[model samples]
Target: EPEVTQTPSHQVTQMGQEVILRCVPISNHLYFYWYRQILGQKVEFLVSFYNNEISEKSEIFDDQFSVERPDGSNFTLKIRSTKLEDSAMYFCASRSQTSSYEQYFGPGTRLTVT
Candidate 1:
Protein backbone atom coordinates (compact mmCIF):
# COMPACT_ATOMS: atom_id res chain seq x y z
CA GLU A 1 0.00 0.00 0.00
CA PRO A 2 1.11 3.61 -0.63
CA GLU A 3 0.57 6.68 1.49
CA VAL A 4 1.55 10.35 1.61
CA THR A 5 4.39 11.31 3.95
CA GLN A 6 5.01 14.78 5.39
CA THR A 7 8.19 16.18 6.89
CA PRO A 8 8.85 18.58 9.78
CA SER A 9 5.91 17.03 11.63
CA HIS A 10 5.85 20.15 13.79
CA GLN A 11 7.05 23.69 13.20
CA VAL A 12 7.34 26.87 15.24
CA THR A 13 8.04 30.13 13.53
CA GLN A 14 8.01 33.86 14.07
CA MET A 15 5.74 36.12 12.14
CA GLY A 16 7.10 37.39 8.78
CA GLN A 17 9.40 34.38 8.29
CA GLU A 18 9.04 32.03 5.36
CA VAL A 19 8.03 28.39 5.68
CA ILE A 20 8.07 25.39 3.40
CA LEU A 21 6.17 22.21 4.24
CA ARG A 22 6.64 18.99 2.31
CA CYS A 23 4.84 15.79 1.44
CA VAL A 24 5.83 12.73 -0.55
CA PRO A 25 4.38 10.59 -3.30
CA ILE A 26 1.08 8.80 -3.61
CA SER A 27 1.70 6.75 -6.71
CA ASN A 28 -0.88 6.81 -9.51
CA HIS A 29 -2.76 9.73 -8.06
CA LEU A 30 -3.89 12.36 -10.54
CA TYR A 31 -4.76 15.17 -8.15
CA PHE A 32 -3.11 16.70 -5.12
CA TYR A 33 -4.43 19.13 -2.50
CA TRP A 34 -3.60 21.10 0.62
CA TYR A 35 -6.02 21.90 3.38
CA ARG A 36 -5.66 23.46 6.80
CA GLN A 37 -7.43 23.41 10.15
CA ILE A 38 -6.95 26.31 12.51
CA LEU A 39 -7.22 25.27 16.12
CA GLY A 40 -10.88 24.92 16.99
CA GLN A 41 -11.90 25.63 13.41
CA LYS A 42 -13.23 23.47 10.59
CA VAL A 43 -10.91 22.04 7.98
CA GLU A 44 -10.66 24.29 4.94
CA PHE A 45 -9.39 23.60 1.45
CA LEU A 46 -6.48 25.81 0.49
CA VAL A 47 -5.44 24.67 -2.93
CA SER A 48 -5.48 21.83 -5.46
CA PHE A 49 -2.87 21.02 -8.06
CA TYR A 50 -3.02 18.81 -11.14
CA ASN A 51 -0.80 18.54 -14.21
CA ASN A 52 1.71 20.90 -12.61
CA GLU A 53 -0.73 23.79 -12.35
CA ILE A 54 -3.28 24.93 -9.85
CA SER A 55 -6.67 23.41 -10.61
CA GLU A 56 -8.51 25.22 -7.87
CA LYS A 57 -7.74 27.44 -4.93
CA SER A 58 -9.50 29.05 -2.05
CA GLU A 59 -9.10 32.69 -1.10
CA ILE A 60 -6.72 31.56 1.59
CA PHE A 61 -4.11 30.71 -1.07
CA ASP A 62 -3.34 34.30 -1.88
CA ASP A 63 -0.10 35.96 -2.97
CA GLN A 64 1.64 34.65 0.09
CA PHE A 65 1.37 31.02 -0.93
CA SER A 66 2.64 28.73 -3.65
CA VAL A 67 2.94 25.01 -4.43
CA GLU A 68 5.57 23.06 -6.28
CA ARG A 69 6.79 19.62 -7.28
CA PRO A 70 10.54 20.21 -7.35
CA ASP A 71 10.89 16.49 -8.12
CA GLY A 72 8.23 14.20 -9.49
CA SER A 73 7.84 12.32 -6.24
CA ASN A 74 7.41 15.17 -3.81
CA PHE A 75 5.08 18.12 -3.42
CA THR A 76 5.63 21.18 -1.28
CA LEU A 77 3.80 24.24 -0.06
CA LYS A 78 5.61 27.47 0.62
CA ILE A 79 4.38 30.42 2.58
CA ARG A 80 6.23 33.60 1.69
CA SER A 81 5.53 35.34 4.95
CA THR A 82 4.03 33.90 8.08
CA LYS A 83 1.41 35.62 10.19
CA LEU A 84 -0.08 34.65 13.53
CA GLU A 85 -3.29 33.76 11.77
CA ASP A 86 -1.34 31.26 9.64
CA SER A 87 -0.90 28.87 12.52
CA ALA A 88 -2.69 25.60 11.84
CA MET A 89 -2.43 21.94 10.90
CA TYR A 90 -1.77 21.53 7.23
CA PHE A 91 -2.71 18.32 5.46
CA CYS A 92 -1.70 16.95 2.10
CA ALA A 93 -4.04 14.74 0.13
CA SER A 94 -4.42 12.95 -3.17
CA ARG A 95 -7.04 11.15 -5.20
CA SER A 96 -6.06 7.89 -6.90
CA GLN A 97 -6.38 7.12 -10.57
CA THR A 98 -9.57 5.20 -9.98
CA SER A 99 -13.31 5.64 -10.14
CA SER A 100 -13.92 5.49 -6.41
CA TYR A 101 -13.75 9.31 -6.08
CA GLU A 102 -11.90 9.08 -2.84
CA GLN A 103 -9.09 11.24 -1.50
CA TYR A 104 -6.44 9.99 0.89
CA PHE A 105 -4.78 12.35 3.40
CA GLY A 106 -1.46 12.49 5.14
CA PRO A 107 -1.39 12.79 8.91
CA GLY A 108 -0.54 16.52 8.76
CA THR A 109 2.15 19.00 9.80
CA ARG A 110 1.26 21.47 12.51
CA LEU A 111 2.49 25.05 12.07
CA THR A 112 2.68 27.45 14.95
CA VAL A 113 3.35 31.08 14.12
CA THR A 114 3.97 33.76 16.68
Candidate 2:
Protein backbone atom coordinates (compact mmCIF):
# COMPACT_ATOMS: atom_id res chain seq x y z
CA GLU A 1 0.00 0.00 0.00
CA PRO A 2 1.10 3.53 -0.67
CA GLU A 3 1.91 5.62 2.39
CA VAL A 4 2.78 9.20 3.17
CA THR A 5 6.46 9.92 3.75
CA GLN A 6 8.27 12.84 5.36
CA THR A 7 11.90 13.90 5.23
CA PRO A 8 14.63 14.52 7.83
CA SER A 9 12.36 12.85 10.51
CA HIS A 10 13.84 15.43 12.88
CA GLN A 11 15.40 18.84 12.49
CA VAL A 12 16.91 21.43 14.78
CA THR A 13 17.05 25.00 13.59
CA GLN A 14 17.82 28.42 14.91
CA MET A 15 15.03 30.88 15.39
CA GLY A 16 14.22 33.15 12.39
CA GLN A 17 15.65 30.71 9.87
CA GLU A 18 13.76 29.16 6.99
CA VAL A 19 12.80 25.51 6.93
CA ILE A 20 11.12 23.43 4.28
CA LEU A 21 9.49 20.17 5.33
CA ARG A 22 8.94 17.66 2.58
CA CYS A 23 6.26 15.04 2.13
CA VAL A 24 5.10 12.50 -0.40
CA PRO A 25 1.43 11.85 -0.02
CA ILE A 26 -0.21 8.58 -0.90
CA SER A 27 -0.42 7.97 -4.62
CA ASN A 28 -3.79 8.80 -6.20
CA HIS A 29 -4.96 10.74 -3.15
CA LEU A 30 -6.35 14.22 -3.72
CA TYR A 31 -7.04 16.04 -0.46
CA PHE A 32 -3.86 17.03 1.32
CA TYR A 33 -3.47 18.57 4.76
CA TRP A 34 -0.84 19.71 7.22
CA TYR A 35 -1.22 19.40 10.98
CA ARG A 36 1.06 20.07 13.89
CA GLN A 37 1.30 18.78 17.45
CA ILE A 38 3.27 20.78 19.97
CA LEU A 39 4.56 18.20 22.39
CA GLY A 40 1.55 17.31 24.55
CA GLN A 41 -0.96 19.35 22.59
CA LYS A 42 -3.67 18.06 20.33
CA VAL A 43 -3.16 17.79 16.59
CA GLU A 44 -4.00 21.18 15.14
CA PHE A 45 -4.90 21.60 11.54
CA LEU A 46 -2.81 24.08 9.67
CA VAL A 47 -4.09 23.95 6.09
CA SER A 48 -5.78 21.82 3.52
CA PHE A 49 -5.30 22.04 -0.24
CA TYR A 50 -7.01 20.58 -3.25
CA ASN A 51 -7.15 21.36 -6.96
CA ASN A 52 -4.04 23.47 -6.46
CA GLU A 53 -5.58 26.03 -4.13
CA ILE A 54 -6.13 26.16 -0.40
CA SER A 55 -9.48 24.71 0.61
CA GLU A 56 -9.24 25.68 4.25
CA LYS A 57 -6.72 27.05 6.69
CA SER A 58 -6.70 27.57 10.42
CA GLU A 59 -5.61 30.75 12.19
CA ILE A 60 -2.33 29.04 12.91
CA PHE A 61 -1.50 29.20 9.24
CA ASP A 62 -0.11 32.68 9.17
CA ASP A 63 1.93 34.53 6.55
CA GLN A 64 5.03 32.61 7.59
CA PHE A 65 3.70 29.39 6.13
CA SER A 66 3.08 28.18 2.59
CA VAL A 67 2.49 24.84 0.89
CA GLU A 68 2.88 23.49 -2.60
CA ARG A 69 2.71 20.45 -4.77
CA PRO A 70 6.14 20.69 -6.34
CA ASP A 71 5.55 17.67 -8.55
CA GLY A 72 3.33 14.66 -9.10
CA SER A 73 4.25 13.04 -5.81
CA ASN A 74 5.96 15.63 -3.64
CA PHE A 75 4.25 18.14 -1.35
CA THR A 76 6.14 20.72 0.67
CA LEU A 77 5.55 23.10 3.55
CA LYS A 78 7.79 26.12 3.94
CA ILE A 79 8.17 28.22 7.03
CA ARG A 80 9.58 31.56 5.97
CA SER A 81 10.61 32.62 9.45
CA THR A 82 10.77 30.07 12.17
CA LYS A 83 10.21 30.93 15.83
CA LEU A 84 10.89 28.98 19.00
CA GLU A 85 7.20 28.26 19.32
CA ASP A 86 7.32 26.59 15.94
CA SER A 87 8.85 23.53 17.51
CA ALA A 88 6.49 20.64 16.84
CA MET A 89 5.85 17.52 14.84
CA TYR A 90 4.54 18.58 11.48
CA PHE A 91 2.42 15.87 9.90
CA CYS A 92 1.40 15.55 6.27
CA ALA A 93 -1.78 13.71 5.44
CA SER A 94 -3.92 12.80 2.44
CA ARG A 95 -7.31 11.33 1.75
CA SER A 96 -8.87 9.99 -1.39
CA GLN A 97 -12.27 11.63 -1.02
CA THR A 98 -13.84 14.49 0.85
CA SER A 99 -16.52 12.30 2.34
CA SER A 100 -13.80 10.19 3.90
CA TYR A 101 -12.24 12.29 6.60
CA GLU A 102 -9.76 9.66 7.69
CA GLN A 103 -6.29 11.09 7.12
CA TYR A 104 -3.25 8.90 6.68
CA PHE A 105 -0.37 10.67 8.39
CA GLY A 106 3.32 10.54 7.73
CA PRO A 107 5.81 9.68 10.42
CA GLY A 108 6.27 13.44 10.68
CA THR A 109 9.04 15.97 10.41
CA ARG A 110 9.89 17.18 13.87
CA LEU A 111 10.86 20.84 13.70
CA THR A 112 12.84 22.01 16.67
CA VAL A 113 13.28 25.75 16.60
CA THR A 114 15.66 27.08 19.22
Tell me the TM-score of each prediction against the true structure. 0.96, 0.95
* lDDT, candidate 2, 1-81, per-residue tens: 789999979999999999999999988899999999999999999999998889999999999999999889988999999
Assess candidate 1 and give its lDDT. 0.93
Q: State in Å the error of residue 71, model 2.
A: 0.8
Model 1, range 1-114, lDDT digits (tens) per residue? 889888889999999999999988587887899999999999999999999999999999999999998887889999999999999999999887674978889989999999
Name the lDDT of candidate 2: 0.94
C-alpha lDDT (0 to 100) for residue 107 of candidate 1: 88
Off by over 4 Å in 2: 98-101
- What's model 2's TM-score? 0.95
Model 2: ten consecutive residues of lowest lDDT: 94-103
Q: Model 1: runs farther than 4 Å from truth?
A: none
